[model samples]
Target chain A: MRILVCVKRVPAPGSRINVTPDSLNVDTNHLGFTTSPHEECAVEEAAQIVEQHGGGVTVLTVGPSEAEEQLRYAASVGATAFVLVSNDTGIDWDPQQTADAIIESIAELEADQGQFDLILFGNESADSGGHQVGIRVAVALGRPAVNGIKGIEVGVQGVTARREVDGGYEVYSLEIPAVLGVKEGINLPRYPTMKGRLASKKAEISARETQVAPGAQQRRRLHQPEETVIETEILGTSSDAAPKIVDLLEELGVL
Target chain B: MAGVYVVVEHDQGQLAPSAGEALTAARRLSDHLNEPVIAVVIGEATTEFVSLCEEHGIPKAVSVLDPQIVDYGPELWGQAMAELFSLTEARVVMATGTDRGNEILAQASARAQIPFVANCINAEFSGAWELTRMQWGGSLLEDVTLDTSSLFISYAHHSVEAEPLAAASATQIESIEMNLDPVLCRSLVQDRVTLSEGTTLSTAAVVVSGGRGVGSAEGFASLEALAGLLSGKVGCSRAVTNNGWRSHADQVGQTGTRIAPDIYIACGISGAIQHWVGAMASKNILAINTDPEANMVTKAGYAVIADLHEVVPAIIAEIERRRGNSTST
Candidate 1:
């Protein structure tokens, strides 16, 4: 079965993240870019699915031209094709507009090739975390969609998705032509081999320009959260600290 | 439709704490907009649930009951919410930022063709609603404006404390009938697999988490023993899960469960940005690592510079010794 995976290019955060002086976006001057963690796993999952079944994987992203790095990263892993929905405006698209642009891209691709059996997306973007684009795209496409999925089993008849709930896992069975917003830990994404990287460098990336419209939700600004000053109390060294820990636990009534 | 509404979440005949928190948020919005707070109870909206809402100072409740609504079907629940919104003309709709809460709101927003915001810590209504939403799981904050006829929002999980109002109020329950499309019920939850019971990693009062320094899966047994003594649960970092030392359900990171336990005891974790985002909500953190300069040690409220392998067993032994002495006394 054919599968499609959507990914987002986000700044690679280290120990700390600094926002732009204007509070409009992340200060990428010191940061590199990579695919969001969840989407990276989605690409891996798609590759594994195609390896088991006889099909190909297509990777798509709606970002600036530099986002091709993420698409190429997917290609290096195992994706057969890549689609970049290039937006040169340098402004982030709202969830509604992002979903619309993805829908348009999907329509165009499906027109050339048949509909993909499964579509995958990160549960949410690491940066925006709007948590709406995937579900909105699924609704617009009129397909069954489930988010926060950690496990997926593809069967001849349908697909089984498992979402980790409190104290248990909630399972859902959806037929083909379904969409899933998968979280990280679904799989351990594999590193790109030298040969695969060389192939990815030679791979042709198809680019499409999509017009974006303003949505109801508008960004006002960005700001850092007030940091709570934490005073680290060193109890003791080595095993001697155990007594202090016990005392603190007893004070907290947990002992 | 003009009043603020809170979507109540219930499981196994009891209201989720997130529901209470959502009501608290709704009450704040109600005070700001000068509107009544209404509770929208879906699925098994028993009388007991309505009374729980009343105790929280919600004077009015709308119950949408249907057989297909037994489990969380996003489409069906969203349809019910949309119908309720039209029936009550709710000005603002709020739910807790759990899996179901966010999904149902997404469905409702899509069906109503409106904007839905998730993980909002604060919201103010003055002609247009201004919201402070958590980005990257609270690592960053974004100020946004929602210019919609009707607003849909979910509170950041555990961001607001769930507290009841000072004075209890009488509640009026209104039941509504909804026509749910059969297609919406197609994706209903089919089966549930219970891995562990009692305290879960997210809701546990005390969480003992291990990371790369734990070495292997067998190394976690000691941490588990320590957690058991404290009536807590064992969690792991993304590295442990990636190494197959633990299941993804037990992974604590940006992609895994965001935990807000009363006290989180992190052992061997180096405190990467991904892991810190999930554990930042803990009321207090105690880091046990060999490296004094480890991120976890620097950021934690308390630190013990020691090898967890030795310190953990010592702590466990000390706790058991204390327990035995208390019993003998």
Candidate 2:
């Protein structure tokens, strides 16, 4: 049961995030980069599936050259292979171009080795949150796809996926060679060990380049929402604050 | 005629809140574009659904009815919506940024070979579609333009308040027949497992949320008690759910549930960007933490500089005592 996971690199926003002066991108000078939170869980889920099913995990990302850091991080954890589809144009690819590139990459990889049994993607990108790439890829591939899945169970015939709704979980059963857009709560991603880090440093990364066409959506600019300063009133220390809380709750008419 | 089309969401014939929100957004767009508002309801299209649309001042409502589409499948709904768009020739398509909304619009956009933007807070159309959309779950904003002929957009959750027109107009219901293929229905909802019965975290008036500082699953009992006293629901941060202390359904964060309560009492939460986005819509926020410099403490409207374990019980006791005094009086 070979599995493939797609991930994205985003800014690791600590307390606050600022936009560039031109409002075209995030200011990265003061920020660090990490894999999107949901995709980290997707990588972890793929690793767990391979650990139990006796297969290997392949991780891929379509981003700038610096995105190799995220791919290496996946290798350090448990992924057996890493592919970086480099976009050196310094401009973000629209969802259509990204999906097309991924589809082409999948086809080429399958031609070399064999077809993967499963494909995974984060439910949405943490930055853009377009919620389109996975569904588009699945449609183009003519495979069953389920999004916002929190739980998955692999079986002999098919796999069962669970998605959280407003008050309940909606379950779906899809055949193999299917795709899933998973959320963060699916699994807790593990950290890399010293041996794993050393192995990842020596691991080989495959880089591929593809032509990208402009799509229907074009980003014009980026801006920050007006900030509302909130002044916090500290009640007291210890249990003595209980009465103040009660009084405030009463004032808010929630008591 | 060119108009704004809204996809209405319904549950067992009752309208969902997102339906109203979508209608509100469509109305706003119609006001700017000078076009009529058209609603698309996918289901049995009962009288209730039509009447609800009429009450919201929708001039025309399209019902895409088929037996195969008893429940939602993204592909099937998307196919139906694409057909409706062609038949109606609507200019813009809109839906709320809920799970079903985003999924259906995504499929529709893909099938139509167009670009679809999700979680948009504001949209304006002069010649091209200019919009401000939420990025990183509202922590950042991106201004973008859509060069497509037909625009597809989804409103961010709680971005627009649901409002009705002053004078309701009579809605014309139009029924459309669809021949859905069985293959498109392969991803239908098989079953549903309900975690809680009533008063979900999103709809609760008051939310008492705990975080990593709560220690363990057992630590949530105090939060539950306090929530019970306040007639509220218990919510947890992503860290608590990640630690297996609570179910994902009870989590308040970007990936979980976006809650808009009257008051949100955050206990021991550090207020990460993801969690803060979900709780930012609350009318008032009270943070209880031992560390006064925590993000939650600094950004909240009021802070209690103390440990929540002791503070929660004392607050519950005080509420009960006040109730006892009133009853005796």
Candidate 3:
């Protein structure tokens, strides 16, 4: 019944995103950082599973030392233990390198505390959106894995996962010791309580280092896409604009 | 090293919408590389599907028809693709960046011990293969260089328009027999549960969407009313869904439904990149928000700088008034 969840720290973007002057990274001078939305839900789901099944949930992240913020945030909610696979967190490790580092960290954790029954990850990191790290880890571990899962039901010996499809959903059943890449909306993450905040401040975080080199995909630069300039006809303001809206709707033939 | 490869996806005996576009992308790579375009189709494919390949400029396709391959199994499909790559010696492999497409390609890349890239908008060889891919949905772009013996990538959804060759070459479907490993079917799609009956978010003609400024679940009532009057559907942003104000099924974003309605009325939405990617496909957009600098307001075709609480009811009343006058007359 033991579960592990992986998360990443990402810059919380506003209405617009700007690249660094060197074109290497996101300009985060004016932005705050938060756990990727999908991974936040993953941590919540893991906590709920342990609450029902009576097991500990361990949160893991492979990023720079600053990512300890995300680890502590996981503690504030429900994660009982934390592991940070520390590296130069300023830059992103390609998907292959990231997966390799995670697999090595998982081995070390399992050596200390028996094997985890299930491991969860965000469907994709908000910033990189590589969509492969979880699956790559699953393959390397020789376990069944599914991505884009929204619904999960733990049974006695297996798990039922539901992925959203066009009309309904496609369900899959995998035995224990499996991995899953869950998306947001799988569950509503709970807010941290005052007592939980105090406990998280005292929690100890274990750090691990990775020596894996960068993979084949090397980024040259990041840039904002050219915005299409639209005139954006402002009809009016407040309720006075209602008549103009009706006229426009009529012109568009929706009325 | 011999040709460019594309994995064709089909469901219920018809080609998926992204299949033709993937083939067209492969055609571009094939022509540039001066190599043939070889499509790999697992399981059954209709005649129309094969014709689609030809129309999209695919020179040859390899089909594997096996009972175990009848259903969608990520591992099995991945193995098929890995085998096809070795069998064909494909120089580059690409698929559409759908959930299934990304999964199978990732699996294949893992088995082949190669790096894979997703959501690529464009790629070409300039001393090296330079790729321009979408990051943060479609709001930002990243220029990357992938140094691999055989390239693996997926095209961004709806990024490339599907085009037919002016003079299509007669496409031949060659049967490449494969006895897939039975163990690979462990991850097969086991069951299906229908959440709603019909007229889902992606299929709606008009979509009235709400965001964090919608306040709460009950606050969505006005949006629902507007959608109901227009016989459309109601959608919300990820923020609203995360706040427990609406169901994930009602969310509009990169992780949720990608909708292309006739008109999308966005209320109280700041329009983050994730949400904008899904709504950008709508033919027309109207934003009602207090912040005139919001991304949705700036990108919209029309805007009203006011609170939706006031604007929505007024729009509803005006429509009803006009309807009553015409009926009375």
Candidate 4:
């Protein structure tokens, strides 16, 4: 089945993310961006689905033209085409507008390409970390939406998705034309290959107008919180200290 | 009153602590916004769910229950909740920045076609109308003025300290008829299994955790035995879970559940920040490792320099022997 994967550019993990002094938004001047970890996994899953099922795959992003790099990154990993949807500035749009933009961008792509049998996305964006777009877009399209997915399988019958829930994994078997939001641990995303990188640079993409504008909506005054720290020292250890440690854990309520 | 919307999360008749945390934050944010805090609980049943709102100090509780809404389905929830948001026209709708919370807000944002800020740790109003929420994982702050009839945000539950509960009379609760249909929900919970015993490590007061140094799967039984003795929950590092030595639900790290236990006894844990972020909120930490320089040792309240294979058994024996007469605390 054909697939459409939504990718996002986010600050890489392990890097410190700083907010403005007002705390209403991120301080983006210094931070580096990469494919949101979960989105990378989504790309891997889509590639796997296409490889096994013999179908087309399209990587789409609704950000500044710079986000084409993110789609290229997806193409390097195995996506068929990269589509960039932006107006030059990747202004901060809320999750709703972002999803609206995705729906529009997908429609524009489908108008030219064939309809997608499935749409894949990350469970939550590592940078923005809101995790609202995928399911919201699913609602707009009225498709089956699954989040926290750890494993996925597609076959002659249909598509099967598994996600971690309360105790164990919950497996859902649904017909095609569904949206699956991948979690980080689904599978370690593969690095981009040299051949894939070369192909991505030359990939052709069409631009379309999005009804939703990032700045169209209003926001409020942003302020930072006071930093509170409790300084303490680590105590030494000993066989005799086991009792003391127990006492401390009990006080801390661990014992 | 310009109402504050408090969004709560529950699955299979179980409530997540983030829901209460959201209420605690809402109680304060509402006061600051000059509005009343109203709790909105979405579930298939309202009998017990509504009472939980009274505990959160909610004056008005709206319960929308439909069998089709069992799992964390965004469409059904967004349909019911968006209708509520339109009716209440809340100054702001805040849910805990959880997987499900983000999903609902995303759907609500689409339906309302509004803007939403995610992972906001703190926000202060400059006047009757503007909000500035910090981004970049609490590293920097952005200042922006908001202009919308309703504002949507998912407050990172870890950011706000849980507000202390106040003893007061019961609050008024009005149940809203759910206008959603079973056939309308495309996705479903399908199945739900209640944690029979020893779940909820995130909120547990004490956690008896074992890491890679504990050796094999047989070694876990000893840790479980110790956990059972203390009435504490069991937790593991990401490595242990990856090795299939323990369940994923009990894993603690950047990818796993973030825990705020009162006392965290990390046995054989090296104390990486990835692991620390998950349990750094502990009132006191006791990390036992053979290596004196284990990273977690430096942050630990008391670092026991010893082999956990030897130390854990001894500690267990001591607890069993001293059952009644220990003044260590």
lDDT of 3 by residue, B1-329 (tens): 77888888765466776888888888887888888888878876568778888787676887876678868888888888888888778887789888878888998888777778899988888567888988877778999997666878899878887898887677788887788888778888898788778788998888999999889899989888888888889999998987888898899987788898888999999998889988987889999999999999999999999999999999999888998999999
Ranking by TM-score: 1, 2, 3, 4
**Taking the tens digit of each residue's C-alpha lDDT, what string does model 3 give over A165-232?**
87788999988898999988898889999988986999899988779975688999999887778889
Locate the minimum summed-lDDT window of 10 residues in model 1 chain B: B10-19
| lDDT of candidate 4 over B99-140, digit per residue (tens) | 678777767766766667666665556553344444433433
DockQ for candidate 2, please give it: 0.70
Worst 10 residues of 4 chain A by lDDT: A227-236
Model 1, A175-255: lDDT tens digits are 988999888878889999998898799878999988778767888888888987788999877987887899999988876
Interface RMSD of each: 1.6, 1.7, 1.7, 4.4
Q: Identify the superior model by TM-score, candidate 1 or candidate 3.
A: 1
Off by over 4 Å in 2: none
| Residue B272 displacement in candidate 3 (angstroms) | 3.0
Root-mean-square deviation of every model: 1.8, 1.9, 2.1, 4.9
DockQ of the two-chain complex in candidate 4: 0.34
DockQ of 1: 0.73
**What DockQ class does candidate 3 belong to?**
medium
